[model samples]
Target: MNQQLPLLFPNAISLTIKREDLIHPFVSGNKFRKLKYNLLQAETQQYKTLLTFGGAFSNHIAAVAYAGKEKGFKTIGIIRGDELGSKISENPTLSFAENCGMQLEFISREEYRLKSELSFIENLKAKFGDFYLIPEGGTNALAIKGCQEILTPEDAEFDYICCSIGTGGTISGIINSALPHQKVLGFPALKGDFLKEEIRSFVNKENWELLTDYHFGGYGKVNEVLIGFINSFYQKNKIPLDPIYTGKMVFGVIDLIQKNFFPAQSKILLIHTGGIQGIQGMNMKLRNKKLPIIEIND
Candidate 1:
């Protein structure tokens, strides 16, 4: 509901950032939008428990945990990779999820891979019984409905709407709700040729474009330039951006803007998907880089 910062370029064109990151301290950003419909569906079905998946620091897990607690439903988090409880007392996000009464189930990468199959989900359902399952990142038809609610009629018209593609749920939903005249662009954070097809299959939208070049590093990996940009962006605008999602998307948006990809007089909207808590561990890795030297001709 607060006024978000807008960046202006040449002519009267401008870029507006939807401050979804500020949606809540825990239930923040697109996570909230993505979870909105899932929660309603769970209630409608009279399901008392909600089960979902994510990594140790996953914002999706955190959001679901919080939502479950607030709405009086039991929550479970199926974590990717191995357990990290031996390493530290608590990673902040996981700790928050635990505090919200989410039962954590850490699984191997191979097991997590089978998560999408009905047989695998049925195995869990047999063990837990009668629980509603929300997919990782809450990307589904219901989630799309929730994300569509984030857009307001008063918002400026734009030819293209850009968002970071994670599981492709948010952008798919945005594409589903957007006018035919608008183009939805997704900048993938992973390195793979299959994501475009995956998104197409998920959202089934034909007016979407995927830009794959901006992921300078893979997911959760940040370089010096990204860190510098994150710091400078905060210094200039007092906005906090996580290195994983929004930071990468913003970096991509800036790159595209600099390339004159969008007309100078066109309006652009960048969805700020929230993942701030994940950045807590990025400082050391992002700061430990040696700069390359450039030769000067005298």
Candidate 2:
């Protein structure tokens, strides 16, 4: 569902959010899109188990856990940060995955980088037996295929479609489906320009642009100001945004609106590609630092 933002801008620019987050309580938004066809393919091949990679507080990890359980496939999460193994009970995301029946294997960040290599996957196959491997961030070809369905016929009216970028899979799909007159803007959650190549591999269009200014210090890094913006944005909009992805994208859109970066009367659609599950984990970190926290972590 798409809901218009209540804010009035000087340029008469309008903001509307595509509430993909409401698609599911657990496996919501882009996670749902990315996993949809992959899960179908797994069953088509008769795979009994699903395997994926993520970090301690990864929304992907949490979503896969619940989605696997719901779909009746055993799930394994190879998480980054070996130290997180002992602290699973204290971490909201990891604990949720565990409770959802996901077997968690914590590994060093160095080893995590070898995730795309064939030797590492062969070793995993030897240890865990056969399983359907979903890449880290769930950004494979099938996942991109799933993401292409995010836009519908009604979305053609919007001048700009914006979303947060993680592995570039989601935006790649948007870029593929967006009308030629529409520009898709991606706000990367991490600090890097390599995403251009990642997105380029999946899409052939040049209508998308990555706005890198609103990361707020890389993936999983958040400050009091961001937390405050999230809190207030929620209070006014009754929309919950996770700190890592959607929040930053929304912030960038509004900032651009204020700066007159868009022409008057431009209609923008912001894709809320669900990471609300990570809010609790982020709030835990905010409390540890005595920073201002988001109002809606539930």
Candidate 3:
């Protein structure tokens, strides 16, 4: 669904949001897109188990857990923090994944970074037997393929296409399918330009750029300002945005608009790639800090 913003902008600019968040309840937005073909491929190969990696409050972990359960595959999540293993009851995301029957294995942060190494993978295969592996953030060739379908012929009229960048699969797909006249802008959740090369590896198009200014101190790090913005935005727009990705993207887009970063009369389409499951976890963190929680609809 394309929803127009209520606030009028200068230069006759119009802002619209592609509510990809509404695509599914548990496996919503980019998570749904990323997993679509991977699930089919797993079933095609008759794989009985799926193994993936994530952090404590990761949306990927939650989505993969539910996807595996619904698709009839045994799921295993290699979580980053070993300490989180003992605190599953205190963490909403981990608890949800656990509830979905995802076998959770906790590892040190250093070990987590070596997840892509051949030696580390051999260790996993030795322990878990044969299983289909989905990379962290679920980005792969098939994922990009599913994300390509996010834009349609009707979306060609937009001058700017904006979305939050994760593993770069979603934006790469959008860039590949975007109209020649449209520019795809990515707001990375991580605070780095290293994603440029990662995105370039998956796309041949030169129509996209990563906006690095709005990460709000990198992935999973949010202050009161961002929390306040997310709460207010949801209150006004009735759209629940997760703090890790969509919330930062929306905040950045609005801030850029106020700064006149876009030309007057430019039509903007923002992709609301869902990660709403993280809201409860984020709110928990906020409450621990005695800060205001995100205002989400019941």
Candidate 4:
């Protein structure tokens, strides 16, 4: 559903949000889109086990676990940070995945860096037998195929489409399907230019650009001001924005609007790629540091 935000911005610029978070209770937003075709491919190949990777608060891990269970497939999560293996009970995300019957294997950060290496995958196959593999952020050709369906014909009226970028899968799909007149803007959760290549590899269009200023502190990092913005945004819109991704993008878009980055009367659409499931985990971190936590209806 497209929800027009009531934020009072100058220049008569319009802001609307695509509520992809409502896509599913567990496999919400881009995860649902990325996993739709992947799950189908796994079944088509007659795979009974699905294996993927993620960190402690990873939305992909939780989604894959729930989606696997729902589709009657065994799920395995190769989690980063070996220390988290014993702390599963203290971690909301890991605990949720475990409750959904996902086998969790925690690895050291050093070893986790080789996640995409062929030898590392071979070792996993040797231990777990046969399984369909999904990348860390669930970005793959099939995932792009699924995400491409996020935009509808009605969305063609918007001048700019904005979304959060992780592994570049979601925005690539958007860039592929976006009209030539509409510009797609990506706000990376991480701080890096490598995403330009990652996005370019999957998309052939030049209608998109990345706004790197909104990362706040990088992936999974948020400060008090951002937390304040998220809380206030939800209070006004009654829509929960995840701190890691959607919140940052929304913050950036609004900041740009106030700075006159966009022309007058421009219509902007924000893609609310869901990450509400990570809020409990994020709140736990906030309490440890004495920072304000993100507030939502949940």
Supply candidate 2's per-residue lDDT for 294: 82
TM-score each candidate.
0.89, 0.98, 0.98, 0.99
Task: Give lDDT for model 4.
Answer: 0.96
Error of 2 at 122 (Å): 0.6
Q: What is the lDDT of residue 286 in candidate 4?
A: 97
Model 3, span 70-189: residue lDDT tens: 999999999999999899998989999999999999999999999999999999999999999999999999999999999989898999999999889999999999999999999999
On lDDT, the leading prediction is: 4
Over 1-298, each residue of candidate 1 has an lDDT whose tens digit, in order, gives 4344556566566777878888887888888998888898899999999999998678898899999999999998888877665532447678888888998888889999999999999999988887999998888878878887766665538777888878877887788777877888888877766777666775655988888887777777667687778777776667777878888888888877787888767777888888776765454333345432111111
The whole-model lDDT of each prediction reads 0.78, 0.93, 0.93, 0.96
RMSD per candidate (Å) reads: 5.4, 0.9, 0.9, 0.6
Error of 4 at 20 (Å): 0.3
- Judged by whole-model lDDT over C-alpha atoms, candidate 3 comes out at 0.93
lDDT of 2 by residue, 162-248 (tens): 999999999998899999999999999999788999899998989989899999999888888888899899999899998999999
Give the count of colliding residue pairs in each prediction.
1, 0, 0, 0
Residue 166, model 1: lDDT of 85
- In candidate 1, stretches whose alpha carbon ends up further than 4 angstroms from where it belongs are 1-8, 202-205, 284-298
lDDT at 17, model 4: 99
